[model samples]
Target: MRPPTVLQGAPYPYRANSLNLFRLILAGTVLVAHSFYTTGNGEGPHIRGENLGGWAVAGFFVISGFLITRSRLRTSAGEYLLHRIVRIFPAFLVCLVVTAAVFGPVAMLMQYGSLAGYATTPVTPLQFVWSNITLYMNEYSIGRTLSDLPYRSVWNGSLWTLYYEFLCYVMVWLLGALAWFRRSAVLAVLAFVAATAAHALESVINVAGLDGDFLLFLKLAPFFLGGACVHFVIERWGVNPWIGAGAFVVTGALILGVPGWGGQASAPFMAYGLLWLATVVPQPRWIAVNDVSYGFYIYAWPVQQLLALGGLGIGGGALGLIVYNVAAVLLTFVFAWLSWRLIEHPAMSRIRRRVVVPSRTGSAAA
Candidate 1:
């Protein structure tokens, strides 16, 4: 017998795809990758000059770009922006508070025997949370509490990406809202190609004298734009195995052979290949039912940091590494679950209920 293809009999339920589970795995990849360095093991592993965490972040951006572009087309600009903000900000805000109030205080307690003068310390807990309330991550530590950790003075190093992610959201918000762009998603495809070229030649571009400071944004733009391009292709072609396989091959070459900008340049192909895999995999029901990847992502670095302070993420020989990974994974999961149940889920639900998300197809990506 032949197997089914293209998912949901060619209707291709985007919301029903295994993205949730896939995202969770990406989050885990970041966690494990960070575990290497956060635990003082050096930058974990690398592919094409990117650490595992960097690769995972690229993965997140690729997927995110696809879905967000789809979203902008379906909703009013206001609705799109609102959903984006709500989706990212509430949980992020909570995570900041937890870091400043909970994680920092605990670390201080462990190191200094008290939280005395904690609030007044430079980069105080309030300052840490407030300064970064907008998600730019202006402050990385609270009251200098993390000064002793091997990763020193960085509370949640993972968070720097969130600012970039949100910036990408705004990029989609602006570009997708254009009347002409909305009418022709090929614009998205073109934009993606342009970005890909830029990144693929990043080295030559840098040598030619581009501003040094804009490198980080340039590093991520292609992937996000590629995801947008992938969304266009999926809507037009459905999910064919032939094209998907080809995409994977191209993605592999772009990511591995091209180093530096290779990962960024491979964004569209990578996203398409991942989408194809999502359709083929037998995903668990729980991940679909309760999306915890965001929670997991936001909480992972802190969980690792806490472990590092406890001597878990550091110098864990095979045995210690095993224990640290186990304990950190378990603890991060618990926090993620709580964050989803108590904070993220409820806040999103309230915003969703209060707002009528102008949907043309009556279906939305989760």
Candidate 2:
């Protein structure tokens, strides 16, 4: 039940937090991409399917695959899951709480005029906690049935991917735990292939108007597999960092130019390429330090929604976006620090306490 501690009392390895830094940038990319939706621009060159934001998602998938696999390789399955939950949930709950506090009441009053049913809404503490903790809320419920309204769904739409990432974690963990794959490298390839097949099938279904739900599977699996490939290549055969970085650039360019082509298929190759560069890059003291990216990603959408509700509109073009980003950045940093200090760290410590069996028990078992 105990969560894993921070990489051995601070000063972690070189690549430890770099992917997280990349995720921060990707979160911003998603914001900008979604801004297109908010702006009512349906189709345009810069805001097309292959926009920066799409790439950002790809990056996230890759990171998840690589890191989760690495975590399993380095620790026990129980510890890996605990670390993930502790790192992810506390800040996530905080975000839900803050957003609901700032927006739920105001939106209710503005729309419903009397707050008659505010207590029953998704933003209510009970609803938010229940929906988020269970993770199946999104799948089972329709609009606002879970913890989000229709328009407000975008508030944390980025997290939809996290659900899939969680799935990926389970799959990867099972594969490793069961010794299903002869090598991590083989597992990586299988994941990529599966993801690619899923995506291609989804695209076919969408084109035929058969279904849209399949898109979810297509998007989630490949990127995750891609990340795993990167980890396998580097950790196993020891590919050159520069070669990896260059491959990443090339693959990235291809995807940007033609995003509709089974992007999930290409992500693993690209992720490994980029990861190669990550390995070669000099480890800055700052990079290896604490990561604030997850906090940024989880909180930004909710904060932006709250800001919009407050009439601090992020609609004045580039300047407005900049202002929103700055405010979100500051708030996210504070949240991350608090989460690390008060909630995540303390909870992890408690878990550790529970994990270490007493000497009497150990002697008896021995």
Candidate 3:
């Protein structure tokens, strides 16, 4: 079949408003969940129920699918691909390098001391280099203990999710460029299918005695699918307020364990997504302009780790840990805001200008 032509239409309302806002909110939620996990409160060592923030990574993918799909449908295939790579890759590379510089030396020092007299500690510089460059640590966690790679072991536990997000971006780009799966409706359904299938496959693999780490992708499918489903409903059908509100309520109820709570622990996220969509009717200044959600999400883990090592007792009983975590969350917001203002925004502006879209009515390019 001949390739599908790019659609020349007004930007979809849901995507222009609700989708981006929801993504920021979801990113914030993931950060909060991570803060809880890193704080070591309520969690009694053996992988407690509150690890839901990890799913935020998956939610990110779904948002990406929808947004990237929207971009692909509107812009030329080359411009679409360029936009995503420009938006994501530069910030990612900077973060990766910063993380390496901060943690690499500390790790080397610790290993040096440990093997002062004995054979050089089995430190593989190659592994550290590769892991940071490729974000491989996120694929499967290693260095589970405090003694293992003490300084750099968990340098950025969250980086793994970035890798998956990048992969999804590429997938969407190819689909758009090749004009495969051109319809938004089909893409949405396919998203749901991919998510559900991923989950089923994970469960099946686990049952068949496969390694748990290998099943990570499966566990993350639902959240991504959920986001795509949201896009499909809002953009395709043009969700009315009543229906949106009803969905908000139903998703909330489901989150509260009404009809089969497979991952009820991640209910907050589902609620967040639904409510986020419901509020897309455009109230001026509804969300804070300088929302530091990304900063909070990415930086919280490292701050928590530092707190743990500082003997300030991050894992101390409930109240103390809570307080420590709260402090970290606040600090993360500050850094995130700074990063956005200084690094991310500057880069995005420059890149966005490079792929400018010409106006339809012969107006000046946007």
Candidate 4:
């Protein structure tokens, strides 16, 4: 039998990849990047005007696009939406509550040394929780807490992307209904191409001083669609190591050489490179088994805010940054762990139970 090549590949085991570990690392990268920003140190690093956090968030969308596309293709629309909702909503709602009730009071106490008048404050705890409950991020702060901090009054700045992420999910779901999109690899490639072009076009628009708030959608869509494109490529041809390497080379060139549109154009290559790395890189069993990336991503900002309120960040140098990060990670990991155990996993498990489908032998299996 002939060995599988890039054009015609062998079976790839989905579980063999180390995507979970990559996710955790990306989540940590966001935390580190925010450490610089929340402390007023500036965006830590940039490649072609995109900071580390921006890159990390793009990585997140890429990964999500790939996985969520597969998920949408594999299940009914109802099941797919259910899984997405359960995966996101429960933990998010609970995080809002904890931030409002627990972190808000804690920040108030740490900053003003009193919780007096916290309830009547504009955008109170209940209001904050209720407003952002639908993932629209209607409120960013609870009471006047953290208002004086560098980042200023935001409990979780990382949350603004959730709304966009869900919007992308809906786009994919809508596209998935078309048989041409589902069956034709060409369609996936076209989607990726169109998204990348829009991203580049938006970059050009910003350079011409026509930027607006809504352009963020164009900024993020390419990466997500890039992931979706890779999924189709994998399904049709296979995971090709050589193709992946060439993609990395392209990505590096676009990122380093091009000024305005380079990063935008590199979306497909970046997605492919990450996917390739997942295949080669090994993951720790603990991390592979239990994903705390979402929890960490959601909780890190508030934990850092609380630290700043306690007067930790903003003045000191490297040592201060290290201390702040160490403390934040430890505290935030505890919250993430609890969130996974108490909220995300349990909610997902209940959804899994409800997602019963017929087995090949004419029996129902969950």
Candidate 5:
């Protein structure tokens, strides 16, 4: 069978498939992975060295790389940046306010004697909302809010990745602005190779006990670049099920066989596999219609923390832990749905109206 063709110069068909559902599943995987820690049980399952949450996050970056690159290509820089701001900041700001001002203060009162104590806490304004909103420069907790729990101190542990996601977005914009993306295939190939090499070097450095924040970026950057490379080659490669299956098999084998090098080795395969599943797999209509993934992802950690603070698994054992996780999942979904309908969607629509600009393509591209 001939490979399917996706024109490189064409705008990415954002509504063509069920990428929304795929992202939701990935977000759900992150929730499940965090359950182990949130419930004070243990770490979740890992394939090779990366845990389920890590894999899901990598998948998110991959998809972002592909879609955002296409978005930048099809629109002006100002418009691209505006869309990103509208997509990320409004809902994120809302979540920050709810978590820091509302839930966080309450948790603080529960932990400390008075609201005065919460107000005087160092992390209350500085790290919690200010740093996170500015650039995610600080960690994701305020005061001793969740300190009493088994997990301790951390509020929304899932947020560290947002900084890296934004960093990737900036990188794509810079590269596109420099005309690197407009060059011949050789530049794309070189870029991909450089990313892969950097990832490999990061793994080596990690093994050598020199790991740090910068190394974390190095580790995840390859997956993002791999997705971009796939987009560059989409016209030539298409959505071939056989090829996707083959890639999945290879990735699984590498993860199982060379557990240490598995994640780095599987980066390209993971990108291709995710794309294939997003594009080729049959999607339910309901999943296609609603996109609660971003909301779910942003709210889940706090919801789980709230449940834990409410005495979820004090002495309840395994059964109690299970109950807590299940409840958290359900409540998280509700919160996500509400966020999408009430905050995220409406905000985007309003922002679009205010910041309207004609695309360079002379048509709106998804």
Candidate 6:
């Protein structure tokens, strides 16, 4: 394919992309990846030190970095935060409540004897209110819910990343408030350096004394910041398909060839690849109109666990896995669609209408 012409010195065209569909596909990727863990004998697929779910999470952070930065730039801080709150919390609160009150109690009754035990458990109410209220500080399970399942007690392992995602949002907002986004190129370079250094440090030194979650945040921060860097690159130099293609080849090679730090090394290239797909890939118009990705992402893990609890994958083999994943995907889609229609979209629309901002001059923010 011929390289698309570069459009330098122009505003970044965020709207001319299929990021919504891209995120949906990524969410589905996570579900598929987790299916191996949730189904059958619960022995997940071993893909040579790589996890598709990890990649999907990385993709999420990248997109969030790019889009949220743009969002913060175009609006007042209050409006920006309002948009973030509405976009994330309402649907999430619903999920938390349902999981804690409905699903948790049901699972507890199935596993134990009565709802009294669940009600008496402090973690139950704490899981519901604390997670929804704090946003990042999450409680995955409520009183032995999903305990009978193979994964055992973890209601939603997928949620840990949401904490980091929210952290990235706050970081972006802080940077924007500090005027770093206005000088995006300089900030991107610094962030890129910091990310690489952190990865290198982790790979070389024994940081065993450090908090595991903090260390993990250090590792994943690169992808998020690398995404922001890519946004700067696109804004400054524009999208050249040849550069993207070259990046893809180099990063793919690194991922395949390098040991230990290959994934971290490939963040920039992956960020670029995501941009290429977002901008250059042709997507169906329907994909652009309805965004069920967030719902799918937030709901899939619990749905998978519920299916497992229901004995959908007892056979312990490929057939069992296929059955479980198919069932999970179908049901998860239904929930996602319902969430979009009933909760997320309406909340966003209402919030947007209530909090009006000045019109931006350049391309529409994604």
**lDDT (CA) for every model shown?**
0.81, 0.58, 0.51, 0.82, 0.74, 0.74
Top candidate (lDDT): 4
Candidate 1's C-alpha runs over 4 A off are 1-9, 200-213, 353-362
lDDT of 3 by residue, 1-366 (tens): 422233122323432355445556666666556554454444333223435565455456655554555566667767666777766666666655444445444433444444232222233433444555654453222232234322334655676776566665665566555544565556545655665555655656678886754466555545544554455444444435554446446655554554223442242235335534535645335344543445545666666555555544454666776676567667666666766777766776776644344533222221
Candidate 4 residue-wise lDDT at 102: 90
Question: In candidate 3, where is summed lDDT lowest over 10 consecutive residues?
Answer: 2-11
lDDT of 6 by residue, 1-366 (tens): 432345343334566678888999899889988887776465455443768887788788777777786677777788788888888888887877767766777677666667776765657655556755666655666775676666777777786677677777777777778776576568766876786677768744444666667677777777787787777677656666767777789877877887766766777788877877677776788767779999999899888888888788666577877788889889999888889999999998886743343433245444
TM-score of each: 0.91, 0.75, 0.70, 0.91, 0.86, 0.87
lDDT of 2 at 207: 76
Candidate 2 local lDDT, 95-120, one digit each (tens): 56655554455555654456665567
Summed over model 1, clashes come to 0
At residue 147, give the lDDT of candidate 1: 79
At residue 23, candidate 6 shows an lDDT of 95
Q: Candidate 5, residues 50-86: lDDT per residue as tens digits?
A: 7899889988988877777766666678877777877
Residue pairs with backbone atoms closer than 3 Å in model 3 (clashes) = 138-160
Candidate 3 global TM-score: 0.70
